[model samples]
Target: MSGITRRSGLLLGGAALLSAAAGAPDRPWAEWDVAVIGAGVTGLSAARNLADHGLRVVVLEARDRIGGQLYTDHGFTSVPVELGAGLIHGAAASTWELVDWAGAETVRVRSEPRAAPGTSVDGAAPPREDESAADYLRRLGVPESDWPPVSDENEPLSRWSAAWMVERGEFDWWSAPRADFRVVGGYDRLLAPLAYGLRIDLGRRVRAVRWSGGGVELVVSGPGGTERVRARRCVATLPIRVLRAADVAFDPPLPAAHRDAIAALDATDAVKLLMEFDRPVLPADADTLAWDGDLDVWSVSRLSPTAPEVVSVWAAGEAARALLALPEDDRFDAGLRALGEAAGQAPPDPVRRTTHDWTRDPHSRGAYLYVPPGAHDAPAALAAPVGGVLFFAGEATTGENTVEGAYDSGYDATDGLLADL
Candidate 1:
């Protein structure tokens, strides 16, 4: 297929069965059994399920790509590199189902180092009662010199409650330490199959959704011009940040409860910087190196045993914001400097550098959603359907903030829609 055309939009594999209702360009509105907004994993999952049930499903995406945050760039290195989500957090994660179906190869990542509960960073005494992780670090006499310059603005680990710290420590030691896995091919390989046999129109930015009556109407703008689509029910899988930003107007507006939930949910700021080197700077066995400096954390792994040397540096929260504020070249230089410092030598000259700042990306204003201290119920509220006309599904709605969560939320939204019908 060439691409989505204005005259006749690109259709999924089985779209021919619904052509009578969808292919009429002269019609005022393109009709469908269901219209899905956003071509991310959630939307695609919903579309696939609905299409399998004989529903005429049309998925509209604002971006040219389909994966959304599941982006994997094969051209970045000799081996595929993920610019968005890279890890399958657990064996039972729904992502693994897709991986199996796609026959994609996966490699388990080395376990992360763990700190025992009440353990001191500098071999000092145990933490005091109710001491936060940051406070514990300080009590251990861990030098402030170890942290990045933006550490002052960053939320101190010490702010975390004791219960939260204990849970994190246990999870790090038992669950997350060595259970992570990466798709040898790229996340796209696993996700792309979900769009099969569905109509997916790329570059269709939904500008407005007017659902005042028995059905919903969508005003979509694309490269060619504006078009309106109508459907009995609509599934909106837009990211939390996008919804919070009111990027797409909703007619009659969302209910106060939904609005409140949207307002309560927070999207985290994050940046991933990928650099390729002419030679290894760190030990070949080194899989991860965490810095107390501006870089925050750097995960070093060869894309493949023999692939080009690459390292992925990640920063979140305020550190990410600070990093993003610098010019691109400056950020690259900072990453190089941090890597060199960690390697205890001047790092080899990097052959290439790339980064994706989720905070600045229009489609995804932030990395993922999180609930504030008192807004634990926000995800449930956000996931609730509005009068059966609008359905919500995303990582935020699922409260999991993982690819598997997004996929499952899509199914949950579809199930809700079917039950209503």
Candidate 2:
């Protein structure tokens, strides 16, 4: 109480959780039964699972909204246009099982895994030719022999290389590729059902959690006021970037190994721009296109063939960040340019355009986590439990890094916590 003081603060937007100066415990401190930070798919799933089992749980979401990155532009389209997660990835039982549980609409679009025949790397009108992802990589700098053999030694990668990978019973990049489905209204719908009875503080921005003592105490500040919440344990589902920033001060500091993993597995900044055309500019038959540029891929989603008036463009990686840095008018112009370039036709100017600058958002420091080429195992370390109380779970924790993976991690973390208790 000697160091506690009232401080002035500011709130920028819906999900921007900001904090003012504060003096909290720097030494080992209390713990919580469970403190789930973040409210994205992962945090939501973890909190829901824990609460379902009759455990005391509280989900602290830095953003004003619950769904962290499952941003579906329902306002723009009747059929939800996904700005964050677009695919279920594979025909696996877990993700599909969640879909069934959620009771969301499902659609089976033929997976167009191959780059359009003659999909030109040179930015030509037509695509280059039929080629496997491996061939595409080989054409770059990767050696064919260097690739993990398509065998037991590399089951998933091998299966991904199979021609029938996209077809049923064949594995793609993931172990079991399911028919890609979009949550009918929006991915946000998926959040509602899971969060039914969970206790979540929408505007609470957790600044620090000290857990060196018997329990955990979190300093959560928001527009209303700042308060300390206590629990026997805490599960941090905050993005890796937030942890890397040392935003939440730990009592005795994190272990050097955990610190190293957090630094190594820090999330990369990814951007997504959704543009809705007055009329379909690209062929519906072209489900997705993986371009060779600062951008990774783009897909055409005219969910209702009868409604050819709308489609969304998705940009990832450095391209997305670059797009966010541009002026608003320039952003729109650049998207239109990319559309025309991809379709080899004049693209209709968008009737509506929406962009999310997640990088600039304080709550979520980056898009979904990505493991670079080497740090494959680093993610597991970042997720490992600390002192049987301080647990970590999020997109970065799971290797798949999909919505399902995030959900599974939360659920798994909750299960792990309950078992330990």
Q: What do the candidate models score in CA lDDT, each in turn?
A: 0.71, 0.61
Local lDDT at 38 for model 2? 83
RMSD in Å for candidate 1, one decimal?
8.2
What value of lDDT does candidate 1 attain over all alpha carbons?
0.71
* Structure candidate 1, residue pairs in collision: 12-198, 132-158, 133-158, 134-157, 134-158, 146-292, 147-292, 148-293, 148-294
lDDT of 2 by residue, 1-421 (tens): 0111111111111122111111212323333457788888778777766755656677888877887777776676555577666666545535554454445676554554322222222321221233343544445444544443222112223113222222212222333223565555566766754665566778899988888657688888988898898988888887777777788888778888788777766455565666766666766675554444444335435566765455445555556667778897887777777666667776777777777777777777776564443344566787788888788887666644577778777778777787888
Model 1 alpha-carbon drift over 4 Å, by segment: 1-29, 113-178, 294-303
- Candidate 1 residue-wise lDDT, 202-305, digit = tens: 99999999996588999999998998999999999988899989999999899998999888766777788898887777676656665667564344446566
Model 1: weakest 10-residue lDDT segment is 1-10
Question: How many steric overlaps does candidate 2 have?
Answer: 24
Q: Give the root-mean-square deviation of each candidate in angstroms.
A: 8.2, 12.6
